[model samples]
Target chain A: MKAPSLQNTLLVTGLFTASFAQAAELEITVENLTRGIAFTPILIAAHDMESHLFVTGEMASTELQAMAEGGDISGLEMVATSVAADMATNPAGGLLMPAMSTTTMLSTEQMNTQLSLVAMLLPTNDGFVGLDSWTIPETPGTYSVYLNAYDAGTEANDEVRGSGTPGEAGMPVPPPLENVIGMNGTGVAASITNDKVHIHPGNIGDAEIDGGSSDIQNTVHRWLNPVAKVTVVVSE
Target chain B: MTIRLLRMSVATALLIMLAACSDDNDDSVTEVPEEPEMRTFEVSVFNLSANQPLSPIAVIASDGGMLWHTGEAASDGLEALAEGGDNSVLIGADSTLGSTSGDAPLGAGESEMLTLSLEAGSETSISVASMLVNTNDAFSGITGVDLTTWAVGETKTYLPAVYDAGTEENTEMAGTIPGPADGGEGVSEGREALDAVTMHSGVVTADDGLPDSVLDSSHRFANPVMKIIISRVE
Candidate 1:
């Protein structure tokens, strides 16, 4: 009986060491590739395979809505903690400007093998750049992934000045964006057409600044797909 | 306890034998210097836009030269190719080890394949470019794509982004475009608002309030205007 018990203890210890061997240190850099748009505080997390920050064609969770609509990540942080995910929040310290980049280091646990990131696009209602769950490669190397803008589908992209609350109808004009955005706009859309998260139909802003259908500038604020670039280096 | 001890000894002996076998195999497989050989690559470009006709495709393989860089002034060769649909200057560049050009303009939803061959010893890279002939200087391409590790039969696909040459403004005027939209002149020597290359902020057609534009809603396009597939055939 004593011999069997000792062998069991050895087996458990071996398994524990093997699981710790799978741990990895990751250096992640997120770059805002747009020429004019800015990204709100970014949330980078390494969670389990089943977890996701936001999924396309699926209704967004309330936490995703807060981040997409108001650039708030507190709710997401709580969710991450509940799932035992490794996360680095607000690595940019503030809004990441156009053509600027931010880097963060994340030490991931054995089960946390997937990565995700999200940040709101200022001057647009409920529009956020997102990376759904991407499986982290087991090999030690550098990899890059491009991100696209997605609409939370919780608010109308009215393109007018309004609140950032989840159910708002207009864009949140942060101080840095105040001078660049136009005013006295009628509004672009009245209701959400797609009730699930979907790829953003690029902003249809007008050239008129004082009065137009949208308060966003057509030439300055418009962007194509792949608005952000995320590079991840996996190291043991 | 005696059985466990015997089992551990057998496992250690097996591990040592496995290590010895691997070492012997490594010694037998010595590294050999690679000889310079002619390598052939097939590049295919597909137009994915609604009404934008792609200029004749230019495919080039070189050591490490880039056709154009963002935030930098366009090269004279790049300027002529972007403004006009003529790829002669780029195809005839000094840095290109091998180059090829499509026979004619590729219409929307059409594709063209061209082949290039280069002697391979040093690191090699490929570049591909084509102009959206309806616009002023909008072009889509991929530059400095490494082909060092690509297998002979392996193929890769890319959705390239559009760029503005900045040599000519996107006026969308009657005599500014070179395609069927306007049968206008090509390659003006004027430098306008921005003299450096940048990602194209899409064309604002006449239906979108650009009253002077000769383009209509059909001319508008989004990102990833072209699909490129590269394969090493030889």
Candidate 2:
């Protein structure tokens, strides 16, 4: 019995070392592919496979809502830390403008084999660009992934300038977006339609600057799928 | 007979030199000249929109050539294809190695298959482009699809999204659209307000509060308005 128990301990130790040997050096670049939309401070996490930042068709967690609604990452960072996840927060240091990109490096720990990223799209209420739980490849190579805009389902897409706090009604127009976004709009939507995270239905912007149904510019603020392009380089 | 053999040997030597210069990984040199192999591909495009009629499809095979890029201005050839249903400009581009075009417009829920053949091992990518004639400067197709690794008889499918050429505005007004819904002008002379290419924001028809728009609900569409299938036949 003692010999069997010793072998079991050795087996566990061997597995631990094997996982540690798989730890990778990763360089990630996030590019805002939109022509007009701006991405807030991005939060990228390398975590275990079981963990997820936000899952489509499921209610968004409080941490995800905070980030999606207001571009806040503190809550999400705390969650990642609690799960022993490796994270690179705010690599851009500020907003990533249209067609601009930001890069960060992360040396992932053992069991951290999945990558996720999130950043709030300015001029949107609870809309964010997200990559949910993409499996990190074992082979060392460069990989590309496209991310889409997600509706947090926590607030109405009023399309008018308002608070960025959770459960808000209107979009949070930052200083840089103040002039670009419109004003004096009534509102596009008054209630959250889908209560679960899903692909954003897109902005229904108007052409009027002072008095339209929405404060977003239809020609400028709208976008299709693949709002962001992510490039990941994996190395030993 | 001796002179003919010498000419054949010289031609084979030149072919070997050109092959070595073209491909870095191809090291083996053939002692005898052989017939150049031909590779063929079949491309099928199916329209999925309610009312948007796709223009004649232009299929091009090249070596890493792209028709249009996001966040960039449309080329004159691309602008002509997107604004009007004409695909001649793109089919005649310099990068096109082998190309084919559909003879007629593919209507809603209809599909068309076009074939192209090129010298094997020369081109490594394929591109397809067609315009949604109902809207201003809206096109749907894919660019830079890698074909070097595709096996013979291998078929791949894709659901392509719509792209706004950005050469014209989405005014949806009369005389702006060129489809049968409006029968308006095709490509105008000048560029629109936002002159850089981007994914289309979709048509804002009359049902969506664009009062002056000539389009209706049928003209509106979401992402993936076309289904594309590519197969390497030979």
- Share of reference contacts found in each model: 0.05, 0.02
- Candidate 1 per-residue C-alpha lDDT over B47-153 given as tens digits, one digit per residue, 9 for 90 to 100: 76656788999997877878899999988878888889888998788888778988899876556667778786768789999888989998999999988887798
- Here, model 2's chain A TM-score works out at 0.92
- Which residue pairs overlap in candidate 1's backbone? none
> RMSD to native for every prediction?
13.5, 14.5
Worst 10 residues of 1 chain A by lDDT: A192-201
lDDT of 2 by residue, B1-234 (tens): 222354477579989999988878766986887868878787877675656788999998867878888999998889999998788988888888878998988776566677778787785689999999999899999999988888899998777788999998888889988898799988889998878889887887874588999986457665666778788878
Model 1 global lDDT (CA atoms, 0 to 1): 0.83
CAPRI category for model 1: incorrect
Runs off by more than 4 Å, candidate 1? A1-21, B1-207, B210-234
- Candidate 2 local lDDT, residue A38: 95
Error of 1 at B79 (Å): 34
Cα displacement (angstroms), candidate 1, residue A104, comes to 1.4
Which pairs, if any, clash in model 2? none
Q: Which of the CAPRI classes, incorrect, acceptable, medium or high, describes model 2?
A: incorrect
